[model samples]
Structures are given as C-alpha cells and as structure tokens.
Target: MTLNQMFDFTPVYIYIVAAVQLFIGFSLSFAIGQILPLRIREFMYYLFSFLFLFIPFLYEIATANVQSGMRSFLFYLALLITIFLFTKESFLKKLSLFFILIFFDGILEIVICSLYWKGICEKLFGLHYTPYINVPNQKVSTILIFFLPVALAEIAFNFLFPLLWKRYIRFIHLTTFVEMILLPVLCTNGFLIFLPELFGMTGWILLFFILFVLSLLFLHAVTQIPVI
Candidate 1:
C-alpha cells in the first residue's frame, strides 16, 4: 500500500474532540484548584492547565502516532507531575493521588471507549472500518476507535466532577473519595478485559449507558459520604 493509504486522516468530529480535550484539561486544573490547598493566581492556573492539555497533542503530532497508548498514559502522568511541582502538598501524597486518579481515569476511558466503539459507533454510526486503516496492530486500532468517544466522556466528566466536588465538598474525606472512584474503575476494567465479548452490540450499548449513569451516581454518592 502507498504512504497515503498508510495514514488515517482524523475526522472532523475527532478535531472537535481535540478541542473538547483542551476544555477538559482546563476543567481538571480548575477542579484541582478547588481541592488542592495551593493558592495560584487565576490567570497562571488557566495558562498551566492549557499547557498540560495541549502539550500531549503536540507530542502526538511530533511522533506521528495518534494511537499511542503510552503517550496517553504519560500525558496524565506529566500533567499531575507538573501540578505536583506547583503544589505545597507533601510530594508523596500528591504523587499518590495523581497515580490513583490517572489509573482510575485510564481504566474508565478504556471501558467507555470500548463500549462506544463496539456498540454505538459500529452499530449506530456504521463506523465498521478499522480504527487505524493503515496501522497494523489491533491494540492501536482499538485505542484509535475509542479515542473520540472517550474524549466526549472526558468532557462530560470534566463538568460533572466539579459539580459533585462542590456539592459534596464538605462531606467526603479524600481517602474515601479515591476509594469510591476505584470501585467502578475496577469493575468496569474487569468486565471489559475478561467478559467484554459476552455482550452483544445491544448489550454493550445498554452496559455503556448503565455505566454512564452509575458514574454520575458514584460521584454524587462519594461526595455525600460524611466525614467521620
């Protein structure tokens, strides 16, 4: 195949998704500001947030590998590390929370994207084509297929997470919050990795929607947990 055939031009929707990622990145920083004890200037906080979000995309472009799994993982890691640099929190505490949140988010991203690609994008949108037409690995194809849907989820979570943080902000302890988030992450990852194919397309759709609802519920429930 020719070089043209080897490249998969991203769709317009995916470009929109990139813009959403920027917003989500900003939202993450904003959320951290609300929770972290640091007192950064508003303007600088927004600037660093945008930097954390946009740099990964630049890295992807520089490498010409949009389906990079490690890059996606590293993006969040780097974002948290940068945040760590600015915060006054104990380094171990900050770093531990960073890893926890990143792991939770990564697992959540994978599950949601898998369900969307296997169910909605394929069955509804008729996007039957491989994720990376020219790319060879099935894992890469899987990552690429789910990237946009995950972006959409990230955008929604960006807004919703902060809202939960605001409402339940006084109630939940930090340790409890992390534990609450971990439950769904573990369950969803297990289902997707081991028993994913058990769900037919319709089943996947239902599962995805159920998980979406549960995510909101989980956030609300965590915030309502009283600090003993």
Candidate 2:
C-alpha cells in the first residue's frame, strides 16, 4: 500500500469533497459574474458564490485532512437549509438546481479520489482524509475528469434553457434525494448525516431563517434585473 492508503485517507478525502461543496455552493464575486450571466439563471448563483469567495482561502488554511471535510460538509448543510427555507422559486428551477448540485457537493469527494490515483493524494482535503479520519476505498478514476464538467453542463442547461421542460419537479427531486442519500453510503464512514451536530440544537431552525432571507434577496434581485 502507498503511504497515504496505509495511513487511512478517507476522512481527509471527505473534507476535500466538503470544500468542493463550499466552492460550488457559493460561486462568489459579483463582478466576475457579469462574464457568465447565464450562470445566475440557475441555483448556480449560490454555487458560484460559495466557490469563488471562500474555497481557495479555505484550501490554504485546512489540510487535505478530515477537519477540512467537516468544514465543507457542515457548511453545506447550512446552505441547504437556507435554500429549503427561502425563495418562491418554481419547482422546475429547484429541480434544475438539484441536478447542478449533484456535482457541486460531490466533487470534493471525487477530487480527492482522483488525486490519490494520480499519486498526489494528501493535497486533497475533507472529512475522511485527516491523519485520524478514515480512508474511502475504491478509485473513481473515470469520474474525476467528467464529474465537474458535467456539473457545469447541468448549470449550462439551466442557464441556457430558462423555460421549464417536460420533466416535473417531484420526479427530479426524488431522484436527487436518492443520489444525495446514496453518496454517504458509497463514501466512507457516513459522516455527512451528522451535519446538524456541528450547528447545535437549533441548527435546523437557523438554517430555515437564513434560507428565507437569501431567497428574498435572490427574488428581489431577479425581479429587478433583466435576467430572470
């Protein structure tokens, strides 16, 4: 076994996945957004905000360690709760956002696995990859290159096609729910379930409020701008 594999890299790998969540979730910087106006058409507005503002700095402070994963994982739960609470977006936009979220949240996990295959594992971050955390087995080699780009494609789909398509929101959300639940299983140690733990007793409630506020901001902005 390699040094990292022998040492148990799962938790840190989880952290890397978490970092990607923050990145894709936020998709930050207002000025840069002008260049890619279509990005805001989907929930990618949030995704881009999270990614642009915090990821690189976060990458610098944290390790390709498990704590990093916890940061990513914990932060995203906060974000999801925010979304669930706020905004009057149609089910179709919500479903489209769900599709984009597939990669935005999962990429952290996928990237760590890719780095490992490339023999540069430690540089990747997240919950299961810390010195004390667990190492996920299985090399998702093919998934690495394609995953993010596909996420980008999903974003593009929502961006370019603002009108709702033939599919229904219920169907897509249910499918997304399956994928979300499945990720922790296929990933090691199943730590994502513990998200609210990091936030304390009222975490869910707080998340709801934040979502409410953000949704208002998004709606207000969308109504004012010519885009939506």
Candidate 3:
C-alpha cells in the first residue's frame, strides 16, 4: 500500500486519544505525589508499578477479551504512571520526556508496520497486491505489526532515555510547556471521539501545524532550562 493509504488507515486522532489517556495517568500520579508523604509515595510507586504490570492479565481474566483495545490502553496508562513514579527527574522534565516518548513510539509503529506490510505484499504478490486479496502468513504479519514496533520502542527508550536525561534535560519549571502539549492532545481526542465527521482533513492539517509549532517551542524551551 502507498503511504497515503497507510495514513488513511491509521487516523491521527487515535494517537491523540492515547496521548490524552497517558497525560491523565501522569496527572493522577502527580496529584498522588503531592498528597502522599515521600516514604508512602515511594512505597506505593513500587507496589502500584508491580500491580500495573499485570493490568492486561487482569483485564483478560475479568473480561476474557484478550484482543480488547481497552486492555492495551490500560496497560499503557499503567506504564505511564509507573514511569512517572519511578523517574527521579523533576516533574516537568518527566512530563516532557513522556510526551516525547509516546509520540516517538507511535511514529515508529506506523512507519515500521506500514513498510513491512508493503514489502511483504510486493514480494509475494508483485506490485499489484490489493488489501482485499488474502495474503499468506497474514496472522504472522499481524502479530509482528502489533508487537515488533512496541518491543523496539521499549528497547530504544531504555537504552537512550538515561543518556538524554544526563546530557540534555535540566530540571526546570514550565507549566505552560506541559499545558501546550496536553491541550492539543486532549482537544483532538475529544473532537475525534465526539465530533468525528466534522474533524476532517482541515482539522488534521491544523493539528499538524500546532504540533510543529509546539515542537519548535519545546526545542527553544530546552535551551532555556538552567543547568543545576
């Protein structure tokens, strides 16, 4: 499939919804961080992280729906809370990095999966493969598309996050910076969920423009963070 067709299949707003859920989880963690004593927060962080890791399993046990999208989303939300509690960085830096990491993961997943599908289609069926035609090993391709990008993104984050933290990120207060990231994600998510038909190409274009501006602002903000 062409890139445009691939883009058409995966709406931009799905990522926005995921981002909103992630931010909500982060906000909840932040609120908990405020209310709890340090010792309690530390203890709960470990405890909750361990339990959150089993969210998908718990979901499967409760609903018997192994392929439910809600299960995956809940797992990711749990992961965000786990990271928020575990990271030693200032809250603002943690929020910034979490946003970037989520964005990076979504981009990686789409690009890798789309390319893999295209390559396999072309290899087995020549250049004229259509989505309607059943391809061999379809189940294997589906599994790879679902799991490989996530695994790769996790590995990349584990390897690179510490380096980025040490070399680049400085502890800073920037509530506006975090708000800028959160607002667009939340708004897009709401629009797509409630008023999807009205949110078309124009809305998508506007969202991309907003994201580009935010990215530039983030880069500038990074430069202004004072070194401790």
Candidate 4:
C-alpha cells in the first residue's frame, strides 16, 4: 500500500484498538470491584473514577492528535463538573481528589510521550517515529508500545493514590480544594490545549514542565490542608 493510503487507515485502527482496550479494562475492573471487601471496594471505586474520567484524554495523547486531545480534555472537564454537581458525596473533597488524579495522569502522559519520542521506538524497533508519520510501517508495534505503558501506568496510579490518600490526606478543605481544581483547569487549557495550537511542539513541552511544577504544588497543598 502507498504511504498515504496506509496513513489514512490509522485513525480507524486506533479507534478500534482503543474501544477494545476500554471494554476490557472496564469489564475487568468492574468484575474485580464486585468481589473485594467493602473498604477495598472503595479503592476500586477510585479506580473506576479514573478510568471513566481520564481514558479519553489518555487515548488522545497517545495518538498525538491535538484537536481530539482538546476535545477529550473538555469532555473530561464537563464530566468532572457534572459529577461534582450531581453526586451526594462531599463534592469539594471528591473534586479535589479527582483533580489530583488528573495532575498525576498528566504527569504520566508527559513521561510516556517523552519515552516514546526520545528513544523507545528507536531502541525497540529501530525506527524514528511520531504517532502519526511512521505508524503504518510498524502499526501494531507502535500502538502496543504506546498503549501498554499507559494502561499499566493508569493501574499503578489508580492503586497507589487511593492508598496514599487514605494514609496521608483523609480530607481536604473547601477553599484549598477550590484552588486545586481551578488553577489546574486554567493551566491545562493554556498549556495543553491553547498554547500547543500557537507554538506547536514547544507548547507541548511547556505543558510537561508547567504541569509537573503545578502538580508538586498540588501535592504540597494537599498535604498541608488540615485533616478533619
């Protein structure tokens, strides 16, 4: 097949792969959640929360499609706001935890992208690559290389954060939670979405640096919030 023809099918293939992954991930997580003890089941709820909220953005970032990435981020933001409004739980505390999850997810995205772009593809398959340009040459390998790390990272963070929160931060205050969610949304829109449109890859790198620093601040603030 000609290069253009091969590239043309990339999006369709990506969507199919992503759909399958999501189905399997959700099914397994739900099944496991069903069997766990009640306290541990709450942690499983945290896992479900990340899967529901962040997977769209995860797939978009893996594909390196900025337009779709923007849409996914906006979709995630909308879902978060909706959950905050409708849920019976303490909205502020839950929203704060969700944003913290987002910050870590963003950090993971940066790491995955860095590893992929810098040397992973070259070392693994001896091909210089971006998500789009050279995919047709190594389609399955490329997709698996990107997808596996992301999936594994999601599982790791989903498990780890709940434990950390239970141990270190049992609750967050209303004011701190407000700042936690608000600033990240503003910074994410600017760095991940808008600036990338204006400045291209430079803007993408800036997202990593700025969000990493912001995440540190987020962690610090969460730790400092007086535990109720």
Candidate 5:
C-alpha cells in the first residue's frame, strides 16, 4: 500500500532473519568439507583461517536478540566438532594450526551473516517481539574495543608466526605485506567505517587471489605438490 506498510518493520521479521542465518553456516561447512579433496581443504583452511579473524566482532553486531545469541553460539561449537572430526591437518604447524582453530570458529559466524544478507533467512523462522535492542552495523566503539585486539593478533598470528613456520614464511610474509599495505586504504574507503557494505569486493577478491596463488607457489617451492 504505502512505503511504511511495505517496509515490514515488525520484530517478527528480525527473528525470522536471524534464525535462517544460524542454519546456513554449519550446513554449508559440512557440505564443503565433504566435497573437496584433502589438499584443497588444507589450502582452503589456510585461506579461510585468515578471512575468519574478523567474524566474531561482526556477528556480535548482527543478531542482538537473546534467542539468536544463545543458539548461534551453540551452533558454532558444534561446527567445530564436525570439522575437527573430519580434518587431516597436522598438529605441528602450530601457527597455521592456531589460525585454523580460530578461523573455524569465525567461519560459522560469517556464513550466518552472509545468509542474513541473501534474504533467505526470514523464511525459516518467524515473528517474535522483544524489547528494544540497538544493532547499529558500524559499531565503531565496539569494533575498536574487541576487533582491534583481533587485528593486532592477526599481525602476531598471521605475520609473525612465519618465523617459526619458516618454510611458509616467505609466502606468509608476502601475504601479510599485501594485507598491511591494503588495510589502511580499505578502512579509509569506508568498509570498516560504514560496515555491512560490500564496498570494493574486487580488492578483497584480488587480495585473496594473490594470497592463494602465493600459497600455492610457496607450497610448490617447499614441497612437491602436483599442480595439475
């Protein structure tokens, strides 16, 4: 009828959207782990491990409902159990392993957020009203307080660990160097400042492309994985 009526501003809408996100994360991880090869999984785990570092802080912003929070936490915990049970990653690559663990936790959260954007989330769960809760997407204070630590930790974990994973250091160095160079520019351009926008997805697409290529090169230089 009118713009106001068309908007669907009901609390029921929030509940439904949040519920769908929780379902998609764990389900997709399972599907992916099942389909890909072992080596591919190793590469993906490394790639996704770094990608995941930003997720928890993002999710903490997205779903402010009480029911959403509790169930989502449990779902992530379960996703970890499933992946660990199926993984072939060695225990020794300590830095890589550390990233893998944290990334595993974060991916579940990211997948949930992605679903929220896709509009499928509302269909699975519906209409519940609750007290007012603020979920401003670009939560600058909260992001700085929680995610600043994560960003610093990424420096230590992603950039510094190469000293020990000496073989992969060159590639990790290259990877982190690129990230170091691009991160400030990205922040300035308003992804971090604005939040929830896919601003310049190309940069990230290229960045990850470079990281994966470098990883392949590094793996090739050190070990003789077939490149066919």
Candidate 6:
C-alpha cells in the first residue's frame, strides 16, 4: 500500500483545529497577562487556556463530528467566563476583554485563511498526493488548503501580534476595543455558518478584502486605546 493508504490523514483537520484553538488560547493568556495586573505565572496562563480549548475539540474528534456551532460557542463562553474570573481586572473590563479575546482569535484566523488560502491550496495540489478518503466538494490536495496556511499564518501572526501590539496597540477604551473586534466576529462567523456559499472563490476575495479593511480600522482603533 502507498503512504496515503498506509496512513489516514483526513482526521488531521481535527488536530489542526485544536492547534489553532490552542494558539488562540495562548495568545489570549498572553494578552490578558499584559493587560491585567494579576501576578499569574506565565505557565499557568498557557495551561489553563490549553485545557479550556483542547478538551472540547478533543471530544469532538473522538465523536467523529467536529463542528463549530452554538455548542462550540457555549463551550468557549463558559471557558472565557472561567478565565476572566481568574483575573484582577474589574468585572466590566473582564467581560469586555473576554469578548475581545474571542474576537481576536476568530478574526485572526479569518484574516490568515483569507490571505494565503489559495497559495496554500495550489502548493498542496502541486504535490499530487491523495489520501484514501477524500473530503467532499474538495480534492485531496485541497482538503488541507485552508488549514495549512491558517497554521502558518497563525504562527506568523502570533509572533507579530505581540511585537506590533507593543508598538501599535495603543489602548483605546475597553468598550470601544470590544465593539470594534466584535463586529467582524459576528459578521464573519454568522456569514460562514449561514451563508458559507457566499464565501466561495470570488466571495472569499471580496470577504478578505472587507476583512483587510476592517483589520486596518481595528488596528487604528487599537491606537486609540487609553492607558489602562
């Protein structure tokens, strides 16, 4: 049997999705660590976020249906509430930051996937390797097109986020920051779930363009953050 037949790589997306959530979790911990005056050990922050994000997806993977829906949102919300309670920030600030973190995680992925998806898909197609069971509506080469670049973009963005944050992320009011980030999360997530067909090819190009504009505006809003 060929390597593709030897190893099943289809469920790999579960791991990839988990990995992205972990990255988001870590980024949230780091961001919260920076903003809050709590004296949390850096390791604990990562550990908490890891458990919070990992467990649900792990369960989904085991069950053979890894979906992002109302259930997923509720799981995340519960975890966010738990994490926020661990912080020293005021109640309202904690709530705002919770949404901000969620928004950041969601939008960051959208931006990366939007920008590099085609390049990643093309590169994979060039390899001409096919897994045994193919994904519906997609070729084997393209099955991971979204995940691979999102993974790369996640790493790059995570690195640049901290650096640029220090330089470019001036503290606007907490409420404003939350509001700005929230728009993209709602629109992107809602559109994706309800009208995913609108996100195909040309739609993705337009969606990405719109998201790019929003990201710029969000970054500009970041510059307005008041020193908290």
Candidate with top TM-score is: 6
Could you tell me how far off, in angstroms, the CA of residue 157 lies in candidate 4 after the best superposition?
A: 1.7
Write the residue-wise lDDT of candidate 4 on 1-228 in tens digits: 753365564454455445534543343333223322233345546465445645554545466342344544544554464344434456555565555555655666567767865666678777664554235344565666656666666556555665655566546464566456655655653335654765799977976777787687677667766663
Candidates in order have lDDT scores of 0.56, 0.41, 0.48, 0.53, 0.38, 0.57
Q: Quote the lDDT for 71 in model 2.
A: 51
Cα lDDT, model 4, residue 214: 67
Better of 1 and 5 by TM-score: 1
**How well does model 2 score by local distance difference test?**
0.41
Task: Kindly state the number of residue pairs that clash in model 3.
Answer: 0
Candidates 2 and 4 compared: the better one by TM-score is 4
Global fold similarity of model 5 (TM-score): 0.27
Model 4 C-alpha lDDT versus the unseen true structure: 0.53
In model 4, the clashing pairs are: none
Where model 5 places Cα greater than 4 Å from the true spot, the runs are: 1-11, 27-72, 91-228
Per-model clash counts, in order, read: 0, 43, 0, 0, 1, 5
RMSD to true structure for each model, in Å: 10.6, 12.8, 10.8, 8.1, 16.3, 8.3
Better of 1 and 4 by TM-score: 1
Off by over 4 Å in 6: 1-12, 119-145, 190-228
Which pairs, if any, clash in model 5?
Answer: 12-127
Error of 6 at 23 (Å): 3.4
Segments of candidate 3 deviating more than 4 angstroms: 1-50, 60-69, 121-146, 164-228
